[model samples]
Target: MNKLMILTGEPLTRSILANFFDGISDFCVEGSFEDVPGLLSAVQNSQVDVLFADAEYAMQGNFLPLINPYGAKRPLIVLLARDGQAAAKSYEMQNVIDYVIKPSTPERLFLSLQKIRMQLSLINSYEAVGAPHSPRRDYVFIKVNKKMVKLSLDEILYVESVKDYIKIVTEKKSFLVYNTLTNFTASLPEGRFARIHRSYTVSVDKIDAIEGNTVEIMTTRLPFSRKYIAENQLKVFK
Candidate 1:
């Protein structure tokens, strides 16, 4: 079972988190605290696997770093908010594992948890597979206008949708390809590329900045669609 510790300032928020995970047999809410001091103490002494926290506390400058010390072995810290806009903004600047918007239904919460679980599993699998000496298999080549181009996996900036076609933007130039964003997405490596918008598939590494639902790739800014918002929390980047 995974042990969890929740930190929220509001009494209602703490209660909601407790009830949300009450039925999950594999998860255990070890404790809930309204202040950062207690939360830090609990985390230091207990085997907490995750921390569901409020963005306000994170913004207030609490023990956020302790929850993710050394950048490894850090407990997944999920931030709770009322909407995706605030969550996206907070996540862009903070190191929270994920975000849960308020008025969040049980189904939404479960799906978020499931996504985190899957990410954790994938990380474990990768570690077990041993680090490959060769380059990461996260890029693909495409034929454009009778020309064969070798695109670097990490150099992809963003993808744009143009009616029936999709344009792939890299560090150097943009390539117009004869494929749907969805179909082209299937050809690229998973985890590394995310469908942030219906018309876009962005390389997680090329993101230079994020504001609201818009992600800045180099000089190009792209919109993040609601359909692919969940992908934003997958930890594909950094």
Candidate 2:
């Protein structure tokens, strides 16, 4: 089970988030704070997996400074904000998986949570073993529903996770494979594809810009985490 810790100043918002997860399975609300007053303590006690915080609260007040300093592995952050579009560029948080706009439904929040769990799984899956695939050209085969199809690597702009499945997004089309990013990546040539973030992987040829931790690929902004950046750097237009 993933331990969830929430940091929000709004009591009503905090209660809503806490109550929502209580009804869900495999997750327990470890702690919900009015501020970052006991952030480290809660993390110490429960070993929080993901953090849901309010951007508006953090910006004005001295809430917890985004990342968990004492943690061996920093908890993944999911920023909750009203103006997510505006906050996207503002936050640019490497640890933050995604930003959920305010008044978001459980469906939307769970979708992001699924991606987060898959992401953590992917990283752990690859950490111990070497990937068997080498950079291949021409065509690649991917799982689509119960059928298998060949997709040209050049046509693919990026890939994102949706629940237990992965979405292969191409220039003109998109397809979902009932697979994890760890498995879905086996179809791609490592030399050409970059794991921009946990929930995202993009073709290097498709990247438009790299500003701080964010990568703009084909009109979409994706993030790369701090851990990966130190070892591998992606090619960016500017």
Candidate 3:
């Protein structure tokens, strides 16, 4: 299980976050502190995979120097901010992966943790299969407008099935092709894409958050079937 820590100046906020994280299956709340010194000490002594910190402490604590970005021991930070300015400022730190505005709800926290879990799982998968000499497979070509167009795998956000056609969505544009979802997905690299639903295949790294049957990618929420959830539970979340 991933070790998690909560650092908030408010007593109520610290208690609430600690209690909320208590029920999470993937993480163990190793420490909850209201001060910078105690939190820093705990992090130095123990192995923490994730840290949740309030913007107030994050800004005042000068925490960046203590963390090494290149080290394997670095903890992923989830910032909790009361305002946009502080949140934006906190984002300058290299380890801050996500930020949640104050008055956090159980649902919001769960969604954030779910997304983090997916990311950590993806990282582990890549590390397991990574090799020094492996050739990079970064892009693929597909026929679009009667011409073969190069599509970078990183550019693809998700794939949607529309009857006899499939739509490939990216950050900027989308492409419609005369192909089945399975056929199109097979062309992509393995482990990078997942068949979330019968009509949807999502880029694992592109997923923003997951709540119930819906997976959020950018601003869009795509429904996923329980079949994928059940079968990939161990493989994805383990």
**Against the unseen true structure, what C-alpha lDDT does each candidate score?**
0.70, 0.67, 0.75
lDDT of 1 by residue, 82-133 (tens): 7777665456322255788775678878887996687567546655674564
TM-score of each: 0.51, 0.48, 0.51
Error of 3 at 182 (Å): 48
Structural RMSD, model 1: 14.5
Pick out the ten consecutive residues of candidate 3 with the lowest summed lDDT. 65-74
In order of lDDT, best first, we have 3, 1, 2
Best model number under lDDT:
3
For 1-238, candidate 2 gives per-residue lDDT tens digits of: 8788888777877887887889878778888887665675566566667788887654442333323432113466678888867556435333556778877788887898786787567545643343355333545655444233667888989889886557889879898754456445544665677776788888888888878888787788888777667545733332
**Stretches of candidate 1 exceeding 4 Å from the true structure:** 93-97, 130-238
Q: List the residue pairs that clash in candidate 1.
A: 81-102
Give candidate 2 misplaced runs (Cα > 4 Å). 57-67, 70-73, 127-238
* Residue 129's lDDT in candidate 3: 72
Candidate 1, residue 133: CA error in Å? 12
